[model samples]
Target chain A: MTVPALSVQGLTTHFFTRAGVVKAVDGVSFDLAQGEIMGLVGESGSGKTVTGFSLLGLVDPPGRIVEGSIKLNGTELTTLSGSALRARRGREISMIFQDPIATLNPLLTIGQQMQLAIAAHERLGKRAALARCTELLTQVGIPSAEARLRAYPHEFSGGMRQRVAIAIALLHRPAVLVADEPTTALDVSIQAQILLQMRELAAETGTAMIWISHDLAVVSSLATKLAVMYAGKIVEQGPTAALLRDPRHPYTAGLIASLPAMTTPGTPLTQIRGTTPSLLSLPPGCPFAPRCDKQTEACVQKPAMTLDGPRGWRCFHPVGQTAGAPT
Target chain B: MLGFIIQRFIQAVGVMAVMSVIVFFGVYAIGNPIDIVIPPDATQEIRLEAIRRLGLDRPLYEQYFTFLANLLQGDLGRSFVYNMPVLELIGGRLPATLELVLISVISATVLGVSLGIYAGYRPDSWVSKTIMAVSVLGFSVPSFWVGLILILFFAVHLGWLPAGGRGDTVMIWGVAWSFPTLNGLSHIALPAVNLALFKLAMMIRLARAGTREIMLTDTIKFARAAGLSEATILRRHLLKLISIPIITVFGLELGSTLAFAVVTETIFSWPGVGKLIIDSIAVLDRPVMVAYLILVAFLFVTINFVIDLVFALIDPRVRDGASA
Candidate 1:
């Protein structure tokens, strides 16, 4: 079998606070093929971003990857030293941030930042690096790419700044790209444009991407596969189209139902009923059992991920399984 | 950019004009200097002659106008204490003060910023904690006390350096300077460090705060995500981000150092304008006092102007905002 571009298994990241251990990403597992896009969907604090940070070994103190194996192209990244991990970061796995302006240094020109990124990974001459940077900017649909290189971050509009950020991420053409809500801060129209560009670029470069966002609509259109997270664990995972049409987990169902389009125009929009439980004092069994309508005595005990071919879910009484039957 | 600078220059001129008026009127409001200068046994004619010659017999407005006119003609009046032109007296003292302020500022900034970067980078480390503790002491201790302590330890106890005064004299381009000799350096060292302690502490705190704040910012995270090494991140992102605040503090501190060097100079018996100001104030030397205040104000405005220009040059946002 061909090795996946990125493979993560039993990934558990925890934060040791004064109160207790907060399991930000507990027993999460996923796989991505080259050129595939996986939408890591969650509410705020659902550990989507933490999972991304963990993959890059970017988690700071008080938080650590307690247990996990993140293998990229069959190379175990968790076992690598800091310098080795840094070497692989921009060269093999790069990230684009939510706020593009934050991703860029305001004092530096676009050219200077791009050159620094280039120089970090490669020893290209100044002329070659500028040429490469210009090409990447052009690829991202920036007009007057060469002239725009001299412009600082503030000179560009919000949308253009995001494009610059995306271009910088793509400069090295890393094997995997982690985009942490890269477009959520942008205008809707600009978001659509960036989404379209990213999809095309991913295909062209065969770069596997993990796009983390709270917006399901954008992810539904962009990603081929989807993983729904609830209270720090992947509650459901499957093909995006299949999962959206027939969601197995109640949380997934509620998320789908809560979409404004799912409800009749005159009626109120459906909501998930309760907020996500705090990571500090999550219930012993299932994290989402408190809010789930389908919860039973069996749910009080954590349900191990039950897989049926490629699709899987962590619920004892899933939607499609013997509806209303007592276990 | 040019327009912005010109506008700032005009604003500075207006500020200096307003300050001159305040200093002129405020000095005159104090007890008349003639009372201190002329003896009580002097005849009425002698007193009248002294008052007229000193421009004190004229109406306040007339004196102010005369002062402004003399200022326009590049004259700061004559010092009653020294019986010399106020400008000449200030000119004689300006170089020593400049040298002291310059040396102190450079030493403080380099040491403070370097130490601050280290502390901020590893805030949880013991070294950082120790530096922070020392900085707290640096901020709280009075400069005069610090100057005394420095003299006691380095000069008195160790007998390694001189206790006070600008040492040897050198003339270069017809301008007298404290020669860059060992004795000269030793004499200036104690006072300069004493003058620099508080500002050094402030710079360290500012730099530490600035660094810590910048480290948490998203741009720095992005730089890390982009695979830039820690050193690269520090150089490219952290340093640049912290620089604006450091520069601002440095500029303001430079002005304060010149203004407040009175304590340090007096402690070390260093001959600077600060010492001159203290002496003039005691003797009610109005011309010297007024000239010094106005000169310090001008220096402050000029420093701020330069800082703003630097801000514009370093940050394009400022540059764009200025042009806009």
Candidate 2:
């Protein structure tokens, strides 16, 4: 079989604070083929963003990747350092942030920031870089791209700034694009437009993308594969359509049940009881065990990530088992 | 932009106008200058002549109007002690003070900002801590005491520099500058450094805080993720982001430096306006004192105006506000 575009195995990132060690991403693993989109769904503090940061070696001090192997097309990234890693960052892998304004420098115009990103990895003259930037803006559905190049970050509205951020990320057609909730900050209509554009861009560029978001609906519409994380670990992983239709993990099933559309119109929405466990002091065995309705005596010990074909889950008693079905 | 500048100019004029009235009345409120001008044993006729000649006999309101009208006519009146035009006295000394302030401000900003960036970039490092410690000392120590200490080390003990006074100078555009000469530079160095220490410390703290804040911003992180080198990221993003605070501090500090150069000038006996003002205040020279106050007020308003313009130019958000 052809090598996957990006493969991560046993990735564990921990943050050492004065209070305690936070296992932000604990033994998470996944693979993405070329041009595929993997939705990483999780609540706040679930280590989804940390996982993205770790892939690019962007984790700051007090937070570090303890054990992990990140491979991009057969080349190991975790072992690289200094210029070696930096060389691959924008050219091979890039990221889109949650806030577009934060991603774009306020002092710099769109063309200047885009040119800097492009020139960081490639040698291009001014005029040529501008031409390429204008084209990228156009591809991102920004009209009057040439004129917009002179506009500063503050000049663009929230949605437009996000589009500019996306255009910048796609400038070099990186092999792997990690988008950390790129559309979550936009209005619903703007969100849909950006999501559609992102899907089209990923397909056209043939770039593997890990779309991290808490919104399952957006992820379901955009992601080909889905990985549901809870308390720093992935509870379930499978094809999006299949996983949404039948989530074997109790947490995944609870998330689907909590969606407003899943219940009858007048009935109160179902919510999973208890909040997500703190990463600094998780419960023994599975981090989600305290909140899992299907927990069993076996759950007192953490279950290994069990793989069945393309599907994987970490739980002693999954929801799909007939005996564990809820009345 | 033009309209904004014009509006600021009008505001500056209004400020100066109000300041002139306050300075005029404030100087009069201080014990009468005539007391110092004429001896107590002098006859009543001599006292009356002195009061009439000095325009002290006029009502406070009329004297203020006359002062304002004379100010418009480029007259700052005559100094009671020196028996010369206050404008000429100030003009002669203005260059020296400006020279000292210019050198001090430039040196302080460059040294402070560079050190601050280095320290702020790695705040936990031992070197940063050491720099911070030194900066704290710079801030806490009084300028006069620091001046004496500098004199003790560089002049009295090592004999490497002069302790006071303006040294040899060359004229540029009819103005004598103390640069490009060993003697002049060495003479100005001690006083300039003494004046700069407090401002330098303040600048370091401002720059450090600004740099720390900017480093954590999302754009900086994006720049890092874009594979830009640390130096490039600093120059392109961090420096620009921190520049607003630095410029603001520089402007305010420069104004205060000009306003409060008395201590440093006295310590070094530098023939700047600060020293002149101190001597005039001693003799109760009303014209000199009043002229000095107005000049300082004008300098402050002008500096703020310039800073506002520069601020708008640097930050697009401010520029947008200005146009809107």
TM of each candidate vs. truth: 0.97, 0.98
Q: Which stretches of candidate 2 lie over 4 Å from their true place?
A: A322-327
lDDT of 2 at B258: 81
Predicted structure 1: lDDT: 0.90
Error of 2 at B308 (Å): 0.7
Give the CAPRI rating of model 1.
Answer: high
In Å, residue B239's CA in model 2 sits off its true spot by 1.1
Worst 10 residues of 2 chain B by lDDT: B172-181
Candidate 1, residues B1-324, lDDT tens digits: the string is: 888988998999999999999998898787678888889999999999999889888899998898888898999889998899998888888778888899999899999998999999899999999999999999998887888889999989999989989998677666557747667777788888888888889989999999989898889888888899999999888888999989999999899888768998898888889999999888888888888898889999999999999999999999999987
DockQ for model 2 equals 0.77
User: TM-score per model for chain B alone?
Assistant: 0.97, 0.97
Q: What is the TM-score of chain B in candidate 2?
A: 0.97
State iRMS for model 1. 0.7
